[model samples]
Target chain A: MATTPDLTKHRKMHRGSRAGIARRGHTVAFGQFGLQALERCWMTTRQIEAARQTITRTMKRRGKLWIRIFPQKSYTKKPLEVRMGKGKAGIEDWVAVIRPANMLFEVDGVPEVVAKAGMRLAAAKLPIRTRFVVRGRA
Target chain B: MKSVALEAFPRAAAKRNAVKKLRAGGRVPGVLYGREGSPRAVEVDQKALETLVHHATSETVLVDLSLQGASHLALLQEVQHHPISGSFLHVDLHAVRADEKVTVSVPVEAVGEPVGVKTGGGVLEHVMFKLKVRALPKDLPEIIHVDVTGLEVDKSIHIGEIQPAAGVEILGNPGFAVFSVAIPKAEEAKPTEAVAVEGAAPVEGGEAGAAGAKAEAGKAEGAADAKKADGKKAPEAKAKGK
Candidate 1:
């Protein structure tokens, strides 16, 4: 076998001066490979119910768990699933619903502002058994 | 400015194996630094990081991060994902004001089933996940909706379809293609000429007729199964990532 020179000294892209921010942990999770199993429980009762309804509708469409809400709203109000009769124009600001057990999850016009409140909502209101999934991209 | 009390710490020693092991336990290593704040290293839960990424638009989220019982307000600055397989590796959080106007990407969503889909056998496709926009700290969007119900197969839905909220402004080209309705891709199709060539063998000869027919039938069945499966798995992968 021909003796190959040690390539260890050959500079690779990962290490250099002013190096790209070091991977704090493993670069393992970056843009997750294959599929990422992420289950986010609704933190509040309203959030839980809303997420459940959303998922129900989403299941009818594409099954890819793709939902993005701008100006994400706070899940503080009661999620009204009841019809107000003949285009009553039931107004809504922010909402998300997911029923994983039944294979469903949905979100409508969620804003980013509620991202903070969502943490609280997730901690305070999500249903005991509710779950939602999304593709992981590191 | 409504400032959040976010905690700051120095980065942990950079070592591949150490990070993989730590993150496996849900502890993500993160860095924090920006105007008026010094840099530090910190560790946050893996689950918490994923939740924030999903719910928040970008590294633009305000984290009232607490470290060693001390808290400081910060913005989700940068999130690094693995190139081939998208996975969260390290997140960069920039401590900022609770009410500051920051620029970030907000997902642009299509609302209502497309007319192209209703009249045509088309499925809704989302081309953009987040649109870059500028807004106050409180005006970020988890996602934006664009209605495609009126569209036809020849027509398309673009970033122009997105309607910005008050105090929020979209930053991408208004004409960028968000999604469209078109014919679905056909797979595993054999040429007509090829079929004719094979068919001629059976009619032109008689002894191998039974075997040829069975082979052709099996190939058709396999193609049907493949189509059914293609639609099923793409969404599954998205679900797992989310």
Candidate 2:
């Protein structure tokens, strides 16, 4: 299973500045063959899990896989007919707030053709749109 | 500035599979582009090339490349590494004459802490990491060091201010800033509050007006506190007191 940390009892983080869309580290994380998101979207923990499973299964453990993003931001929701001003709703799930040009997954040690095919299958499990990218001359 | 001797063999085939085969055999495929001739495909031992690159102190390395019973002086131009594994993939070497001048980017390093950052509550910002310099192959310095100890707040070191080593000429706009000492963002936002209080004290008319002005200042302070609590336009609180 993909790693997920137990972040219970964590103090509520102050609503900080929005993640700048043009930041550097938001791009590709690891490996040469990867998928870059073209649109900003949120990837829930379960969705990321499904994508990870799809990629590893497709590759058949032949090469290395790197999940560049993590669902660290805690998301919350309120129940129906709830009154206003009750502090905050309990944490429901975790999500990664991904922006454009953010690399969602990467594969290495495999041929370019195999990595592309495997990443295509993984991209099907995600809600946001992504494009295949190859590490080339920068 | 140091020269390392390495042996390379001319690759028989220029096909993709042949390059992969060379890599699998613990060799890195490379190309040596000469000044007046077509590029030649060469393969160097992976371990030797990696060690030479790792030990080299500068971005530009003088390579005494031996290939097919002939040796040529070259400069290591570019290196490609596997994105994940950090292993050498391919390298580009450019043939150079020992007496000719070559332009290369040398890393700029700061040697001392600026007084503005150390005692004046300012921050030192390094604007340039690498500087382009043209010099003879023998006179190239590994790295350029800038002494920043004399820098004061609001002062900056420009490209024109730096003294390059003899026979080396820096290539860029002379006025382009290389490094600077500037007030920190948090400190830059602080002086307006003091200005507002000083501006208000002299404008009051009489004793009764002074009391009313004090009440207004207290109300403004309360509004500023409320704005801070709401986490919106906290900096505007200082502007509002004016």
Candidate 3:
């Protein structure tokens, strides 16, 4: 999992899947907006508090927005273990991991919502992105 | 609907002064809360209470309201608001049947982006407007949808991902996105600023690079300090437990 952090740096990136381009769909740039990160689900009590401080101090004030981000951790238990073998090459197996990261945020004003959110992301260096914008309907 | 025998009282009955004020203004204050028994009322607004009810839990819930007339049986459904001003809207309600199941939409939460996080350095996003569901009054859920399986960055998720319990039926579109993940590009990642050295032997003009780094750091620090000078501080308060 730790290999080739820079591999994608060379490959041309686009929006949607390969099939989309094949059907005359050009991939738009993904996450053209902000900071992003990959972290374990579990956070210590201290880590959580620290994160809250970072978001509120920087994002809320300058951004003029209220954000709600909730990070979560998950784990899996496996039965396999490594045992000493003298004669042959060691063997290994593949496995998967999973977790959730639900969060939400809101801004008071219009247009400013996205701009402030963007500014907050820059200041906080948080690992999040803006996906879509919707208007509240009457 | 599974019927529940609920006991409710007025939320504002103790505020006699407020009631007096409302009575004088001709806006009756009332509450509508009940599962089995009739809804109680101290005073109900022909307009305001109706608007508040528009946003409340439905009739199966035990609402404690007051009215000028006797208490009655009812369920809350809708809350009306000013479309542009976004003020508190009037509430709508229905008289509940003990044996009937009421359907309402609850909220769903999704965390993290799958596609964006994996490839584009983007993260997951959520815009969970709401999800409608049907359940008996006795079986109401404050929130639902715990499992978030196939989500990825750049990929949108819908209501179909929710795993409803045996007795409940979800009433929204299967393609609804309670949450999603994406990288909409809010910032750019410039090369990390270099560390500065003080009076150290420069290697092949390393001093120039160091000077540039110091300048960037100064700029960043200046930005941070300016925030403090503005008297705009974040809440130094700690996070409370759920």
Candidate 4:
């Protein structure tokens, strides 16, 4: 199913500025290993779900996974061949506005090698560059 | 407890700019406070501090800090690091007397593979990575080792069950789980079965079919009302335009 909030205060939202490094959710808190975003980007629900599936399959469902980012901002899209200037388009897909150093996924109860390999495959599914981080060390 | 000897220099400038300059010069600004005359501002070589941290087994590091010919036994209370770069920004050292009891959190290590994990296809999980304990300077342990060889599936080891070292007392909720061997989570159902289940439920209703039908009827009524209102407003808008 498509990921979207059931309730929202505002159905439409403006595209705001994306600046500054992530001050929180940057550390590996839940798991022993994590994938940290090195570049800022809007991660859609599909992308996050795809990465999660990749990580879970890589680990063979032996470990636990934590998804740190949520698609909070909803973006709008105009239909095909539609003219401009009809105010803003309807709400399309929701996206998580990720910043530098934001931790995207975390895995635990698995060996370091397996977690690293899983994160590498998951990073391939994402749009931004990522860094493999270990708990306490990073 | 292992003690590392490090030399520090008395810092003259504690201002933000001064601290920034000091960091740029490869020194980490720190404060030594506790049972002392006053909190002393000091700086240590960045590389040295990093090495000390890298070599330590746990977060609780006992430091033999020497500043301006005076030696003070201090605990590495806190270390602030850059979130992105993970570089040392500042350090806080707490001077402690050898006779006083100090409370600290020590990393917990599980020794040996659990029986459940080895034979029962269970996953061993470290629920609590660190345990807070109160101990004298000499009694502080670098790390606490817990044996989990006999742990069975769905079984947990709690803090109350642990026996600490002599002169050290575990401080926290006694019932807190430290380690457990859990049965792996069940896999998802087959796609066809999941789809069949989804198809059985009403598409528009939140849960009950009657409530869902009622909501759909309400939506249709609201849409008809909106269309009627729009039709009435169109003529008024045209007249105003003319």
Candidate 5:
């Protein structure tokens, strides 16, 4: 199933800044270990799904995965031969604006090695650089 | 709980720029207060503070702070760190007397392998990672260990069932769940099927589906227009990109 938001007030939105570090959702809140983003990027639903699938497959569904960021922002794209003066195009895709230090994924109920391996595999499917973080310390 | 000896010097500079200068000079500026007279600003070496934090087993650490000529037993209440670098920025130490009781959150550790996880292919979930407890400085524990050897599938251990250390009073809700063994996610019943079976009646007519689809389309268009009328609300993106 598509991982877009069920209901959005806005069909399309202007591209916002992705410069600063994440103020919140930066810690490994819900799990023993987490995959923290080291760079800012627009994380599409497909990338998130691909990373989630990779992690779940690597872990063999032994642990629980928490997706911290939701793709609430809608990005629109114009079709072929579209005029510049026309209104905003239909929503092409949904994306989550991720910043540095934002925790993208968290997994628990698995060993540290297994969780680390799963996060490493999942990070390969993402655009931003990521670091593996434990619960207590950064 | 082990009382680690840490040395602190009186911080003469209390201004914001001075604190920044102190941090630049490899010192973590901190405040010491509690059942004492006034809050004293002190600074500890950044390396020593980091070492103490790294080696500590739990968040709650008891330290014997030697300042000037007197020895003060203090609880490491809060330590702020730089978000990205994870470097220690500042610290707060609450001095405690031997007779006074202090409340702190202690980390909970699962001790043994659960039978449900071993035999029934269940996942062990650590529900409550930390427990709040009130105790004297000497009786305070660094971490609380709960044995889960006999825990079965779909069973949980509550806070009331676990035993506390001597002179330590567990402070939170007694019925709060600490740990549980749940069946694997794949085996869990699907929510859609459950809702269909229990809540909604079967829709046999195509008319109803067609009408619902039309209503949904109308709602979407109205929502889009309404959203456009008001300025587009972006997600909590603090930074402005060019």
Candidate 6:
């Protein structure tokens, strides 16, 4: 129920392997502290929602939370025992394509210690390894 | 040095959720303060603010802020953005006077291709992208241009070598290198005579024995030279690779 905005109307997408990230988006959005992905992986919408819920629950909604990524790409799967090459499988779930060095979440208006603890808890729900990062002084 | 006129209104409340309401209403929360006056909370039109910031040539922006029926000179200090949407979240402006000097970071740009890189098959490396400078608000430049056209292989341009505009002074160590022309890795990584000598040395060791060892040791100097050359070449490749 945490995941909303039904996107099932879209057609099935090709399952392309992970590609390396070429650039980090605009530097302005980087917050004081955040979680960075260390490897390429598909983050499901349910997983993102679960991680978000865990952070907000831990923080008690006292601070600002920014989900740096969105689950826009859809992953498809075939039914069990189905014959191959008939057609593409139906859409299974939505996912966000995460690459190494991409920031997953950012927290601000909160103390650094609390943000780190909350991000660590959120990281536990992710499929890929993550590292905590702080914005460097420019 | 160019001044931009901006209008802002005072924000009555300073709560965390107030920012959300302000954004929903198409306004951005900001603060204005510095040595010139007390800190004041203000808000500006989001579209106008985005245009001002987008067109700004440097991090330092001179704004003629019209607030409370008075105009004041200020500089754009810091801007915060929403991590996901990358939208403007907050802005901090520092009040300033035309006569006072302020220290700020200005972008450093290379104007031309280095002779070494163009002809000598070397790579141009930009060691530092921005330089800290001190100057009056009127004398601040949008960017500092360093001409690397004359730079040759193994030569570098240091901070001390740059001649800044009148009234502008660069900060930090003067000897720090801003840009350098380095030999490319492809040319440096090519196998040399020393490598061939080393490859052939071990094969002939059984017959020549001690003489081979002496010859190998003699060739060790050439290997060391090759290694030294490699050490110098690796960094340029790494820099370009990134």
Task: For each of the candidates, give the backbone clash count.
Answer: 86, 0, 67, 0, 1, 0
| Per-candidate local distance difference test | 0.50, 0.74, 0.41, 0.86, 0.85, 0.76
Worst 10-residue lDDT window for candidate 3 chain A reads A20-29
Q: What does chain B score (TM) in every candidate? A: 0.62, 0.74, 0.47, 0.76, 0.75, 0.73
Q: List fnat, each candidate.
A: 0.07, 0.00, 0.00, 0.45, 0.48, 0.00
Alpha-carbon interface RMSD for all candidates, in angstroms: 13.8, 21.4, 17.1, 6.3, 7.0, 22.9
The sequence of per-residue lDDT tens digits that candidate 1 reaches over residues B1-242 is 12334443444656889888877766777787767667777766766777766665444566777877766667777776653234567878776565677777665656777777777655455556667888777666656767777878656777776678888888878898777666433211333433455554322222134335757898999899789878787898799899
Ranked candidates (lDDT, high to low): 4, 5, 6, 2, 1, 3
Rate residue A67 of model 3 by lDDT: 31
Off by over 4 Å in 5: B12-18, B186-242
CAPRI docking class of candidate 5: acceptable
- DockQ preference between candidates 1 and 5, better one: 5
* Candidate 2 per-residue lDDT over residues B65-154, each given as its tens digit: 998998888888888765334578898999988889999888787788889877786656667767999998888888999999999989
Better of 3 and 5 by TM-score: 5
Instruction: Enumerate residue pairs that collide in model 2.
Output: none
Query: Stretches of candidate 2 above 4 Å error?
Result: A1-138, B186-242
Number of the top-ranking candidate, with TM-score as the measure: 4
lDDT of 6 by residue, B1-242 (tens): 79899999999868988778988899999999999568999999899898888888765688999998999998888887654345788889899889899998887888887898677866566678789989999998889999999999899999999999999999989999988877633223323433454544231322234335657897998899899979988998899899
Model 3 per-residue lDDT tens digits across residues A21-135: 0111111112112222222233222333343344333432222233333322222233245355543332121111111212233332124445445545443443333232222
TM-score of 5: 0.82
The sequence of per-residue lDDT tens digits that candidate 3 reaches over residues B55-98 is 43332233432333344335555444332233333344455554
**Per-residue lDDT over A1-138 for candidate 6, one digit per residue giving the tens place of the 0 to 100 score:** 234345446556777767865156423253457787877798998688778766655554244567888876777798786688887877788788887767888765356788888889999999988877765422
Judging by lDDT, tell me the better candidate of 2 and 5: 5
Stronger candidate by TM-score (1 vs 3): 1
